[model samples]
Target: MRVPLALLMIATPLAAAKRPTVAQLQIQVKKLTEERDSLKQRLAATDSLQQDLVAAQQARDQAKADADAARKEVEQLKANLKANASGGDTLLKDLEAARKEAEASREELAKVKAENAELRQQVAAAPREGDLVMLTRDVQPARPLNLNRATPHIKASGFFASRPTGVVVVNVLVSEKGEVLDARLLQGLPGDSPDAKAANEACVQSAKNLVFDPATSKDGNTRFKVWQGVGFYLD
Candidate 1:
């Protein structure tokens, strides 16, 4: 009986060790549930972090695109400015050329006016047909008269003396006796002003007083008409 009792005691202890208590089983189940919840929260945090990374990458790309656009715009503006500068320079050169052309035209106009005046003078001095003879120092006359002797007869008014040097052309008719038949003013100063009229009358009167040799034609006719120029000089 004692031996069976000892064996029974050993068997009882072994059974208690093999089977778990109710309270210890509940603690293990609670621990396993808490571990599962912690793992779920970590997965959620990883997903949110991935989404944030994607958003950051998109923003960076957008900023890069905007910067590139700005740089391109700046380059375009620079090109436009350079083109405008070149155009401005060309316009300035064209203006300078135009000014030079205008100056040359003015000079040419002045030259033409001078040439026209000289031509007028030459036309006035030219000889016409039907003249008896051209009176020169070389031609000997029947009775020579000094033209300088008539200088005292020339009358100068205050108005005529105030003007610049001028000229008067006269036509003179002489008789066979070397007497002046008529004297007329061919051309005088340009205007018909009082000064011009006085100058013309005074020159005509002086020319009428002038004594000259009888000018003859080739046939020795003792009548002639002569055109002469007289200059009025200011002292």
Candidate 2:
């Protein structure tokens, strides 16, 4: 059928407008592909980030465990050091106490030695007399009549000058070193004489050489500490 020319021309322009060009279609396909690929890449990157986060968390846990172990070790070391320090302090205190005790013992020993030395000197410095006899000790205790005839004469000089006139009493204690330690007047004679003191001194001097009989316990034995009183007068 024959178409009108004006209608054909308008229909031809409409068809041309509806159809797309090759270059424009290609551009649109490229843009759509790029957008799909970009979305896939973004999902992959998100997964990688999740894995990194998990690894970091694990590392943090391990670090915490290591720190705890280190802390425990330090605490144990501190405890050990404290114990050692306390033990050392006790040992040092014991050593000091021992040293002080040793010093005190040394001082006591020195004091004992000094006392022994003094006793020795006293014994060595005592007077010596061989000619003088121990008349009172040697005389027979039962019968003693002659006063002037005694070997060691008891002279009535000094405080008892009235010879053979009155009686005098004296107290005496002898030491271990054969020396007169104490002498005192128990009673004085009535006469004004220095003889009593002289007689006492003579007795004391003669008593120094008095030999003692061996002593024993409760058994019947000769005793050493012997005491006697004597009186001398002119006939």
Candidate 3:
């Protein structure tokens, strides 16, 4: 009986030592749950960060496209401005050529009027049938006797002062005594302005002051008409 009781006591202590407590098991389970929750939260945060990165990249690409479109618009405007400038230059050249042509036409018209007046004077000066007795005598042609003396009067006139350079046509009738009987302006410069009229009148006055050599024809008749063109120039 004493030996059996000692073995029973040793068996009882060994069984109690090997058995685990409920508090220790509960603590281990709580620690494992916390570790799983932490891992899940980390994965969720990483997904959100990736989504934000994608959105930013898309915005950047759109901005680049907008910038390219704006640059193209600016280039087109510059090309249009250059084309307009070139067209304006062409228009200016056309205007200058037109002005030169108009000036040439005015000069030509003045020359024609003067030539017509000169021809009329020649026809009137020809001998008539009633003057046959005067035509029978030997005569000399009419010629200027004081052209150098008359030129100074024309230069000092109001007509020459207005148009310093141009042509004036005058018709003069001279008597047998070498005296000017009549003088008139045939044609003058291009315009009929006040200055041109004054010039014409001045030319007529100058012609009246002229003296000529006796114009004796086959008949010694010195009465004749003459057409003259005088040019004025500024030195």
Candidate 4:
């Protein structure tokens, strides 16, 4: 009932080959899993770097404010020293301490500046670094949208400058300080001409750099997620 020797020899190699395929497939699966884990780690690292960069910017700003305050204190101390000329020794000691405080603050400010520059470079060098801007439509400000204080420099080049009766609508996230955090092109021109595209880009830029009154409420608890339309009309 068994196979002959010649047939058995031939079938043996086929079975061996089949066995190796499963092992090879297992190896491939393991390799793929490792790659996936590596990618996940990289993505997590990128997010961490982005957060650090934001924190560094905030620290740098605070350092600058501290330096300014220290300078003002030194100036006031000097004035007090002059006014209290009779108590010269006491005022001189106070002035000296104020100068030292100012110097320390300046040094701290310089250190923060260098750290911020380094962090910025790191963030820029990241291959998969993404924008921190988040555009959301679920925003209701306490006050109504006021374009009276919103003045966008909507000067389009190439097509829009010479053309007339065209409008570009942009959705923007405005901060409590009246700064445009980010913008997206909600509506562009009808056609896809080079000029049209350029105009649309211009509209986005203007929206990003737009100057407007703070859309925040009296308690400053408002988000200015609003649509802004820039238009060109014939004279």
Q: Model 1: runs farther than 4 Å from truth?
A: 1-144, 152-161, 218-235
- Best of the candidates, lDDT: 4
The lDDT of each candidate is 0.47, 0.38, 0.46, 0.51
Cα TM-score per model: 0.32, 0.24, 0.33, 0.34
Best by TM-score: 4
Model 1: per-residue Cα lDDT over 78-190, one tens digit each: 56656788676655555455455545545554554565565456435533333333343432332326554443223335543544234454545555556667777655657
**Arrange candidates by lDDT, highest first: which order?**
4, 1, 3, 2
Q: Per-residue lDDT for 59-120 in model 4, tens only? A: 77877787788778778877877887888788778777877877877787788789878877
lDDT by residue (42-136, candidate 3, tens digit) is 45434554565555455545545544554454455455556677675554555444445444444444544454455446435665422211211
Q: Is candidate 1 or candidate 3 better by lDDT?
A: 1
RMSD of 1: 66.7
- Residue 185, model 3: lDDT of 60
**Per-residue lDDT of model 2, residues 46-140, tens digit only:** 56545655554555555455545545554555566567886766655554554555455445545545655654564355223211111122321
State the TM-score for model 1: 0.32
Better-scoring candidate (TM-score), 2 or 3: 3
Separately for all candidates shown, the number of backbone clashes (residues 3 or more apart, or on different chains) is 0, 14, 6, 0
